[model samples]
Target: MKNMEPRIFFKSSRNVAADTGLSKVSLRAGVGAFSLMEMMITVAIIGTLAALCMPAWTKIKDNSMRARDVSNLRGQAMAVLAYAGEHDGVLPGRINRGVAIPSTVTTDSKRTYYLSTVLIDAGYCSKDDKIWKTVCGYGADQFGVAYVVNSGKSSVPTYFFGNRSSTAGATTYDPKRIVSLKSNLDPDKDPKGKDEEPLSQIWMITNADGENYNSSTTGGLSNSLSEDVRTPWGGRHYVYFDAHVEFKRSGEYPSVN
Candidate 1:
């Protein structure tokens, strides 16, 4: 017995190997541990799972942002409605297009008014740097007036608040026409639901009528707009005179589909 070799027992061979501080087990009947291949497989599985989740995550994020953009439209609409209530069912009917004034509404009335200005004046929206500026739309960091209305009837000298179609309670609305929307395409180009845009894609060309849109951009209506200031999401947001907001697939002007 005194000549017998000393023996040690480990709760598990793995622990013994761990104590040895060796890279691999060398003992007979060594307890098994994960190999490099097993670790690699586990990593691949995890990577695949992440890949699968990415699209769904993107979709959810897009939906949330779209919802937020629509909410902004609704908020602006509410303010417009408030203005209408006070001014004999009229919008904040004072806008100054850099080009020419309309014969119907006199610019001589008072001061110039922009969409965001009016919203701020009425306290419906915050300051421009805060409200009109959004992380959503054509381009992520894109800023400036993110909205415009169906302020005009047929293209003419009219390009102001009163110029666009009546909000709620305005004598009428062209059912086939779109009201206010996110600035994706040329505001001058009236949406007629003409073409199928790429999914989640806002237009880059200004389809506005250079005649009425007279501007440095030219040939359309006025010169107030530029070559696609920024890119927007694929979806177009529509706010009708009814005041209820609707989110539909992104399409060109006129259609509002």
Candidate 2:
């Protein structure tokens, strides 16, 4: 070492450091470039995390949508109840089992009281696209909530519907209860209510057959409830005869009487 020149020693040391730095650089480069297995593991971890989060995220979204729907129905229920109160407790539109007749507002022409004419038009409820248009996903004629009547139950007789345009206007139960609208209701005459109730109906029946209980479509009376459509997110919504609202799942529908 003493025989070694200082300049040569310094040069050797510098070369050693450069080589060491190059080696370190090579090591770091190799470390920075992940192997296929490493990449796969990272991907798997991300995928697992995503899968874990998806259900929760989906639940939150569904809950949010359901809440909005329930709120809409509640408002609609209130309006229907109010309308009934003013008309001596008559609900607009008449529904037996399969038969649905629009409430007759004018006797001259039989202007069946549809949702728009009976409630929205009469200023009982408002149907802004923001409320039920986009949310309900139906056109003006077939948008908003539904109005159904009783078809009777094993325990109760066929009850009456409050038809505002009814000739029995302002008369409580004046219009004789049609037998067709009863426990063994004529499926053809009963246009709206499903099989669970003795009286009254749901706010909106899911996205049913675009017919009776298709609360999404509020304007026309042209079709029937889809045999398959019930509440989509979970169940349907009801604002019953008692002015109470509840979310019900399919097959476990609450009593609307």
The Cα local distance difference test for each model comes to 0.45, 0.46
User: In candidate 2, what are the lDDT values of residues 1-257, reduced to their tens digit?
Assistant: 36965554344544765877756667657668989999999999999999999999988877887778667656655775677677665555543322222332335233333443446556776534333322433331232233343322321233344233224443323222222233334444554455454335422222232333542332333444443443445455555554556766666654432
Please give each candidate's TM-score.
0.54, 0.52
Per-candidate total of colliding backbone pairs = 35, 16
Q: What lDDT tens digits, residue by residue, belong to model 1 across residues 1-257? A: 46987676545756766877754535643446678999999999999999999999999987787677667666666666676666665556445322121121234332234555544546665644443334453432221234445444332223324432225664532211112223233435745443534312421111122222334422243224454443245445656554666554434454321
Least accurate stretch of 10 residues (summed lDDT) in model 1?
203-212
Off by over 4 Å in 2: 1-38, 93-112, 130-222, 254-257
lDDT of 1: 0.45
Query: What RMSD, rounded to one decimal, does every model reach?
Result: 11.4, 9.1
